[model samples]
Target: MDNIIKANQFIQEGKLEEAAKILNEAIQENPNDTVAYVNFGHLLSIIGEKERAIAFYQKAIEIDQTMATAYYGAGNTYYDQEMFEEAVGMFKEAIANGLVEADAYFMLGLCYYNLGNLPHALANLLTATEKNPTDIDAMFQYGLTLAQTEQVDEAISVLEKVIKLDENHADAYYNLGVAYAFKEDIEKALASFEQALKIQPGHLLAGNGKKQLEALL
Candidate 1:
């Protein structure tokens, strides 16, 4: 346990080799320590040894099927590799094993989104937003998902909330413009697009949107 704590400190300090050495020692001393395995998996992930990270996480899951963190770690590794199908199962397992963090739900929703399962993505993202109402990223993504699923009014409302929470969220304004455009509110859409361009001068989408809306006027 001391070794693991020391290893974690080393990890935080960016002394990865030192952390690895200490973690190896910890694993040698107690091969059955799930905590050590999970920490090692996280270290491997950080170092871009994604396959090794998955192996370590799987080992932890093998020893304790109810290890929520192991499943969550594996889910992240798979997600990083763009293996959304595999990541979906891992995230679902993590949730079933008692990892109900909003982040977990958000990742699960992302996996569903990537896999083109819009209904499920919407459902999970809704849960994620409910779990953490102030999470701007989740709320923003949920707004996009709503628009994708043809919920234009809901998307506008959520995007508005995101803008209220962080006035500099250019993407939120851009998407709000799209939502308003979809609802046939030309002036509101143009105003939203202009606000987005004001916040982010480099926003090509907003620029194009502004030009298109201006042409309509």
Candidate 2:
């Protein structure tokens, strides 16, 4: 089997040390292998060695300027370090290099969201959902973004879709309640909040929202 493939299997098995050994050997044997370098970078990032992971990813990029995975790996490492600007640059490069996948778009959206660039975040997150309609997490985040931007009706629709995707998502239910409240649909808001509490008994926000709406009635 290929050394990188073996290392990946070891990684999946939670044998980090073994994966490291195989990846190191693979790099030594074929120093120009961009895939091996990116995999090693990913493993190192998982181990919280962010700086070293960035170095390996940069090495991969150096070997192949068009290596999209290298840029994506570096983007994730930068994001882990809270370097949103660097992450944005790396993610954009990854996209430019043909990494037009939902995962990449989702990460880029998160980076923009963190950087307080709502418009960019919204655009990227919408693209992510278009790429993978079944991604509940992405859909959920997009709904929150819409709510934050005061697009209450649209937010409600998206949050409803999230609930359909995962009936037990307390956060989605809670946010749906918030959207309903914004539109003065008190009964529906109260019901959504109650459903959220039923799903997650300790949901403080939902509990508080239910109380506030009840007081109004």
Candidate 3:
């Protein structure tokens, strides 16, 4: 439909009001158009009307219970609001309904992390990385999670992989240094922290790490 296409175009152009208007009319004309409901909900969310957006998303799901994207969109909104448990439930439902993106698993990992379920967090985050190897944030979180559980060697291994991916990654280097320090490999830790400083002169963690290493010298 031209209205549907126009609404999407308006959304892309940041004309959320126009998009919402068109989508609302389109849905009224064809109440069964799940895409219209989803697009309208997305536009409402962009315009900061979260409650209205959620209402429309619910309508979309009511029309098509198997609409995985609708579940994902609602889950993302819940996650953004820091409602971790609700987000986890919605994401799990989305996945069960066939939403097979890495993002679903990644968000599940974050929810588990916040809830202090470290082992589950690691498992979900690792699954996320396996699904999308280029997921930088997932790798970083995985490394951090490993460190939290005293798996220093595994943490270092994961962070080192991040370094191989991006040599200038200051945080990865800093974390790697911490992992090495936890392992009592002072020399390697100092070298890693110093390398981080080379990339980011004002890196607070690297600077502190360097000073601590120097104290040992």
Candidate 4:
């Protein structure tokens, strides 16, 4: 097998030192191997060496400006560090460079949401859900964003989809309850909160929502 493949195997096996040695040798043999550099960056990132990982990703980008994977790697590191603005820029660059993965759109949505750009967040999250309909997290985020924007009916619909996707998704039920409450449908809200509590008895938000709604009714 190729050195890169062997290094990837070592990485999957949690042998970081061996993987690093092989990747270093690969880079030494062919300095222009952008793939090797990007893989090394990803391995370093996984091992908590964020600075080193960014360095390797930068090197890969320097070698090949159109390498979307390198930009995506750097974006992930920035996102993990809570540098939402930088992550948003990097993810946009990755998309511009032809990266069409749902994860890229999802991260972009999360970044925009964190930056308080609700419209952009909703747009990207909508795309993410379209790209991967089975992504429960993306659907949940989309529902939450809709609720935040006062689109309570749309939020209820999206959150219901999440519950349909995973019956035990207590958070989805909780959010659905919130949406129903916003719509002034006390009975439906109470039912949604009860379902959430049934699924997760310790769900504080659901418990509180149920109590509040009951008191109001």
Q: Estimated TM-score per prediction?
A: 0.97, 0.97, 0.90, 0.96
What's the count of clashing pairs in each model shown? 0, 0, 0, 0
Evaluate model 1: give its lDDT. 0.94
Minimal lDDT window, size 10, model 2 = 1-10
The sequence of per-residue lDDT tens digits that candidate 1 reaches over residues 108-132 is 9999999999999999999999999
Could you give candidate 2's per-residue lDDT for residues 168-207 as a string of tens digits? 9999999999999989999899999999999999999999
Residue pairs with colliding backbones in model 2 are: none
Between the candidate structures 2 and 3, which one is better when assessed by TM-score? 2
Q: Count steric clashes of candidate 2.
A: 0
What is the Cα-based lDDT of residue 182 in candidate 4? 82
Worst 10 residues of 1 by lDDT: 21-30
lDDT of 4 by residue, 101-155 (tens): 7899999999999999999999999999999999999999999999999988898
Give the candidates in order of lDDT, highest first. Answer: 2, 1, 4, 3
Please give the RMSD to the true structure for each candidate, in Å: 1.0, 1.0, 1.9, 1.3
Q: What local distance difference test score does each model get?
A: 0.94, 0.95, 0.88, 0.94
- To one decimal, what is the Cα RMSD in angstroms of model 1 from the true structure? 1.0
Candidate order, TM-score descending: 2, 1, 4, 3
